[model samples]
Target: MCWCGIAVSQILAVRVDLWNNGNLVQDIFLGEIKVPVKVLRNDSFQAWYLLQPRENGNKSSKTDDLGSLRLNICYTEDCVLPSEYYTSLRNLLLKSSDVQPVSASAAYILSEVCRDKYDAVLPLVRLFLHHHKLVPFVAAVAELDLKDTQEANTIFRGNSLATRCVDEMMKIVGKHYLKVTLKPVIDEICESPKPCEIDPIKLREGDNVEINMENLRYYVDKVFREIVRSSISCPTLMCDVFYSLRHLAAKRFPNDPHVQYSAVSSFVFLRFFAVAVVSPHTFHLRPHHPDAQTSRTLTLISKAIQTLGSWGSLTKSKLSSFKETFMCEFFKTFQEEKFTESVKKFLDDVSSTESKEPSGVSEPVHLKEGEMYKRAQGRTRIGKKNFKKRWFCLTSREFTYHKQQDKEPIFTIPIKNILAVEKLDESSFNKKNMFQVLHGEKPLYIQANNCVEASEWIEALCRVTRCNQKRLSFYHPSAFLNGNWLCCKATTESTEGCARCTADVPADTQIEIDGDRETERIYSLFTINRSKLQKLEEACGSIAVYQGPRKEPDDYSNFTIEDSVATFHTLQQIIDIVEKLNESHEKYQKKRSSSAKYGSEENPIVGKVS
Candidate 1:
């Protein structure tokens, strides 16, 4: 679908056409755009151009006023660097689980730095989830977040890192669960469009409010039935995550047992299922975005689900969350206890990981794939000789790569046999941005075009294999060169690694996690944004000093700091640690430069030491 190697003078064009399924003129030419390529020195070009009418004299005149399409386009190109370049940053993030105060964690700091917290949250959640550190990490961060909140009703309300992580996790694991629960109903509603808008004032001409309410009731009933009945189909991973949240919430508020149910309901019902009801296209329940009327119908049904779910969380008989009068009256037709029991049963089924095996297997998911060069691994040779570009794919089940038109994989490594995936020493193959996958004593080396892809591949590979029982305690960070390991001085090829493994996942056949290294990663982030930290400290002081009536347009107003007193204390701890760490960082840098010229943090997460 992508075209390259075009001459500078060549033209780039886009022609829009209209297609009707059963019309006489099924295909009609609309407009065309022909632009001469320019600015060849730059990587991309972006601009809005006017659409010209069809050039042919054979065009019909019936569609003269079809209206123009509105679109905004942006073109960009990125040249990803070799993995060695980002080694310092990647290694820092791998240590995120260990950061104290949680806010100083690399993941949190990344969210702070980005314009949208969701952007940083997605990648960080995926990275940690793959490494078996998601639960503990999320617990620690959310615990700190809870401490900063004074309102019980609004707990975990914002799109904070913890909430966003859970959101992304559900999306990652619940693809099948969503399809099974909502696709059929969604397809029916979308295909057989209905006029279900119930607001009397907003109803269209000739629209009957009574008939619309009946239609609304029918759709809502169908969606609610699908949701409450399909609890068994809920994904195991999501259930596990929800179970963790339930326990965490109950422990936090032992006085109220309803908090336990509401915790799971807040996410499952409000965020996950109800949101899907409103936007089916986002969850892939629908192939295309719905029309305006369909969207309104979905929205009304979505609100009804939310209302019932919220009511299910409370013990009160009164249903009071409805914003519209008609909706309030309409919901009266249904019995509250009937749906409440259904909600309770669904929550119980999802949270129990007892009968069936937990759906924790992230297999068959396309973890990562791109075109990368692989060094020839042969029994006849002791070291690599040449590299060739091949399409590589790593999944939970296996790692495979193939050439174009290859029906089967040319090379594959079973996920179980993967012992250590570490950065390859540049000296071993005389090439930059290289990594090796160790299955047996003989490692398979691969080269990447740049540092980003190299880090991504290593992160993804390490994530899937974190739970493997046979992982190595120590691994050669580098490769064999001149009959000795490049990482260590040992001359024997079979000698153990000279450096200790840095990843938190254990090789001890037990699930062990290190949550302290995350702080070390945060120390680096603090260094990067030292000035911003200072400003935040000043804002904390200002908010503490003044407790007057509300004011806006100030440094303190820029943030959503819930418990300012608690946040101030946490910020002081972070600044103190950051300052102390920077002192040690300075001394370490001087020693490395003066005593050891070869040693560098540029090596991947594990295998290299300073």
Candidate 2:
């Protein structure tokens, strides 16, 4: 009989023991059968049976056939097999229709067989999804969908297949489907734009849309939980998803206070999440880029500060707390010098333009002397009988001087009538003996025979004056020698020209006269003592005299020569010296206190310095 003509029962019972080197690997059995009698008629005709190992004796259902097959044949001991046989066997095992005894084992087998040929499996999974009501089949299809998304995405870029699979899964499991579907979507969204169309109306009507505070809160909480559960190893992707969701939440429930509050709250949690996820070693990475997650975190903080600052009713305590939180976080991140440039740019972008000065406060002004005019000087009438003209002049030291120019004793002299008025330096009045010719304790007098002689005498007296005095009196020769004298006394108290003296004189009292044929004769005269003049000069230089009446006797008496000179230093220089001393003293005190407080060997001065 030919090999092809052999009956099923006539096939040989084939048994094979397989080994690697000397180790016994496996034993496999082929069905009992017989070898054909006429098989040798064909040159290539050989009766052979191949035996393959099964997992658990259930040959039809096993997934992995680990052991090699053995063959019962009439050929030589070392027969060569064609490679096509192994290829055909693999193809047969992989076909879903050929898998018998349907079980998880068979499913495992099918998964492995079709692992590389996803296109081939796609058709069968589609068939199962169409015809099967089995939950396992649905789960299997969902797994297949997840596994094939990248391929499906590439194949159907703008179509509905990708979204359809997700929608079906979600419908089957409700909210729980998120646990299965979110990760793939997160990855996809991060990698590319939303591939599937989202129904804006449906999303708006969803549980997240409820304006009630509690419902919104619940929705936000759920979304946060989902995000937290996702594997966000890729921070860039994580950040993209975060910002997308935040953008959605913000758009959908913009007017909802609770939604706004929850969105900001979620942002805060996300920041902390990034901080926790980033390793200390890699913490400094991408600080400038800061991913979308960190940007959202900073933006939310800024918004909170702005909202509180703007809200008229926000309490001071709440505002303070908000500021404190923002400042603390800002400073912590900003302390790093590497971030300074970027931080400054961000601050400039977000900072308010209006000045921070408080409302209702006036701007400060600087006053100067030229802004106002000086007051005119006025005089008081003296005694009930007469009014004296007096004016005030400002001295270089800023002191005011009251003077009656006409009352100056020198104004009444014959020289005053003879000489033209001359403007002298103001310092001329400050000379030691200038005022002594007018008034002093010891007065000088000259006796002249006539007005021409007196004019000549007055000019000589003015030239020889050497001390500042309170008054000077002029005497006529006849009046002085006969004891009937006309004396003109200079007084600062005079309201008019030096108290005028009119005295009748004896004609015969011709005091000693110097001979000058063309000029008037000279007369007897008295001079102030030389020692008294010297004393007066010393007193004038040492004392600071005021033109006003004395209020206290000791005011002038107690002043020392040195005190006046010392008082003339600039106020600023004095203050600077005092400040330097104070600073040095304070520094010393601080050093001593610090040393005592720490009492370390490095600070040995703690006890010894004090």
Candidate 3:
């Protein structure tokens, strides 16, 4: 298939390098063959010949197939390389060796083009960086003028590639950029007793004296907060900043937990503050995340934090005063009160008026066959804010709600109808505890006494519905965790969605799903033993052969025939016996089915399978 839709030039010739005993013995002409002209750029073709080595004079039998052959396809002589700068640069980079200077020059020229052209070249630069090919990449970056420099920084500040390359650039260009931006902030934060002098080189190399630990901690926290506030889309930049801070801490006060923690805490708080401010309702703090930017950020942050821990003890000198009070208070916000649990019990008491009802009022119908799992008095919303009391009941077969005990049910929902159950924000609709059950287009909103009750009810509902349906709605793991729509199930009309979703495996595809442990053990043993048997035959010069009725002269060797059956004295007998049994069973099945004259559709078992 020609994926590129461009015509490729003809290949001039193919040269083979022959190697013997790990040494290149000779370069041979394997008969000149011309590659087809105007070939589709991305299409592939196959060519094969009898793989035989040439015999040496008086040493023909000594020639062996153990040597290696290397094939090279020549195209520069007959083929025209793409003329566009981008394509030209790609071609330059494609050369195996001795093209770094050419590639570098091409990159510099591309950078000198219009701003958009330079932007297009940025991805290629990033590719080179990703492969750790920094020499030519840095050479190209050095060609950028002041305007190009500012534009590149602006465009890629949030980009992971730029963030990653920035740290490397610091080593080359020195920390003039950081010094210019950070000096003012540091001066502002480090007030009385005079802030320690700032040295860009020392910071870049991870060595700097710390005259004021407290001042540095406050400075780190404030500066990082500003970085998060700037909303630079690149996590690499943010992470590199943390890395620099870690180095500073390491060089200033070795093995000091407080100093090391300042770096870690700064990174954590930067993320925490970023996520908190962006969408207060959700915990998604990842900026430009679920992509390369987020991945780069996480990698850098994790490495930076781990590096910090290695520099000093994580558990040292008891909890810091700031951690003891403020940290404890911060986490307390995420906890739920114990009152939610007791609210369910209290609601049950109030709704227990069935026992005092008049004798004439017949007891409400009970689901006698259904095993009841949960029963609670909850309130279902009527409109936007109307909270009407209802008794919710969950059984093995269905979910039911009643206006009250000893009364006809308001609604009965088959468990299978429940598509999904999700807990709603407690603050939404000014309700303390609420959840919604989605069944097709209609959503039933219900309020519990507290968050705990709402969560428990949602869990119970999902558990029952899952069992009844056996197949839940398909969703990405990330979507489920982030409380977002499944990429596959998104409301968008376009077919484009998550690319990672698995496609159905074709029947012909060689995919093997492993079986149970015992089956695996047996299979492994069978494979090992079969391999040994093959090696034994090769060593003794007695190859295995098939002796069945359909066997040909070319199929078997050193075989014997018995009274009615042909038998082969080889380890392949094990495989032949199994094949014969399978063939006979299949024939017997076909014969029986034909005699009965039963169509597959009439036979549920047969039709249900294939």
Candidate 4:
């Protein structure tokens, strides 16, 4: 499965290094195998490459015989076409909001066809979210999942489409929230390792049992404090999703008092924060894997967090399910009520309406940041000034630029105030690679080092604010210079813009997903997994036709298909769409091949993913 995330060209190289029992590790270059990043780009490329001396090797001779190493590289790039290509599929998905029983929707049907519900859920969530239809679909599916629930404890416990969607949603929106909340302490614990093992059997000889318990207590307390204190930092979108889950869970299990807490905690704590604590590298909290000692320490902390997350279950020492008496006893030492109160409050904050700006949060998401020259907004019309090089930073909340990197920003523009961001006419600024940001009354003019940077900055600005309500409907393409709006030639600075804005995307939109790109990826998945989809189609037909006692399910039983008729109908439509898409792809491929020149070079990333 592929995710829309960052990718960099990196070729693995093996170098000689000393591994002294995981201690005193240093660069001891021995041999190397270099594979071009291009090879992995087209598809997974596996081959045996001979190791040779490093090009910069000063300590080795060419006569050195480095052994051969077998490399298996698996990677893929989805070449998404234009938005028009995906319109039909997008229309069907847009109607997901109105899909009765919700299970009949295109998005939900996609999940039923895939093995890992996540593969379908991730893109579906993003697509529905972009079109502002996620909450309804999630709520509908969750209600379906809740129908089979006999106990409050199991609410959202299953790896259903609804659950997976929520998981991906949190991971998408709460990425920055997690970093702000847990990364600091996670890094502290990793950089400074301390034994938190309270298990007597696991403790090494000469280790102070009391000291270990105290260390464990210290870490748990620190982590808990951060979790509770950072509640306001939760993303608004996550809050909405959690709020829906809590509301639905509570509604379904009206008699169960703690179901609401469990509904939110099941993901926020047990899944999100605690999981990140145990595996910091996976969450990008740390640069690399922690050492053995640090890893052990993190595991202990993660365990404590998970138990504490279940505030109600923590009341029963026996039900806490501690494997060892020491751990159970150590948990007794915890201020159980305080931790419980913290968890309760944190859940409340997250499920409630998030504040405008997260309080006490210094590190907002650094979206796209670099150094650029910004021309001063000179008060006098006649005075000329040179552009001042400044470090500009954009986050979800605001855009600010500083006199120096890592210093106080000289200017700040709240995301709401950004009316428009567009390229400035070269004639007005008399410079290439110039753009302007329309805010309150004045415009901020900036010059990038080059054209690509200029386009990137503009795209990022518009991308982040595309959904902003306050974004102007129109704007002056040229800068407002010498007391005139250059593009409109309007006398008043605040006159209505002469040109309409390109994007009216909601100002409150939290995530920016490429609808066409996600649609293309889903189409590709269907093309590759056509056989599995056909099997599902037949299974849906079988189940709908055979209204008898549920017999043994075939291959499609692996997927959750609650409504066979609805699923079958959706599957038929999807098959039709996929077939059409496949035909288009084939035609495009044929056209390209027909136009190919003799001995012409194609993609250098040789071979498809294997």
Best by TM-score: 4
lDDT of 3 by residue, 1-610 (tens): 1011112223533223222223232222222222333331223433443333332244453223433332233332111112331232334332312323331232232322223333434344344433335433432332221113232112222323223334333322222223333435533432222232233322334435354223334443444434323211112222333444434444445555344334333333323333232222122122111222222223323232222222122223322323334322222322122222222222222112111111112553222221111212232222343456677776655677776765676778776676656554444355556666655533466777766666557655653443223222332321211223343455533223243211111112212322222122222233334544343333223322333244344432321121112112222443343344345545756765676555444221231100
Question: Which 10 consecutive residues of model 3 have the lowest summed lDDT?
Answer: 501-510
Would you list the C-alpha lDDT of every candidate in the order shown? 0.65, 0.27, 0.34, 0.73
Which candidate comes out best when scored by lDDT? 4
lDDT of candidate 2 over 373-401, digit per residue (tens): 11121212212222222332211111121
The better-scoring model by lDDT among 2 and 4 is 4
Candidate 3 segments whose C-alpha is farther than 4 A from its true place: 1-387, 424-433, 475-610
Query: What's the TM-score of every candidate structure?
Result: 0.54, 0.13, 0.19, 0.69
Per-residue CA lDDT of candidate 1, range 419-537, in tens?
87777778776788888888874788888889888876876676566545577768887776666676776888889887645432211112233333333433445566677666665
Query: Which ten contiguous residues of candidate 1 have the minimum total lDDT?
Result: 1-10
Residue 89's C-alpha lDDT in candidate 1? 51
Each candidate's number of clashing pairs is 15, 20, 2, 13
Please write out the lDDT profile of model 4 over residues 237-257, one tens digit for every residue.
567678888998989988888
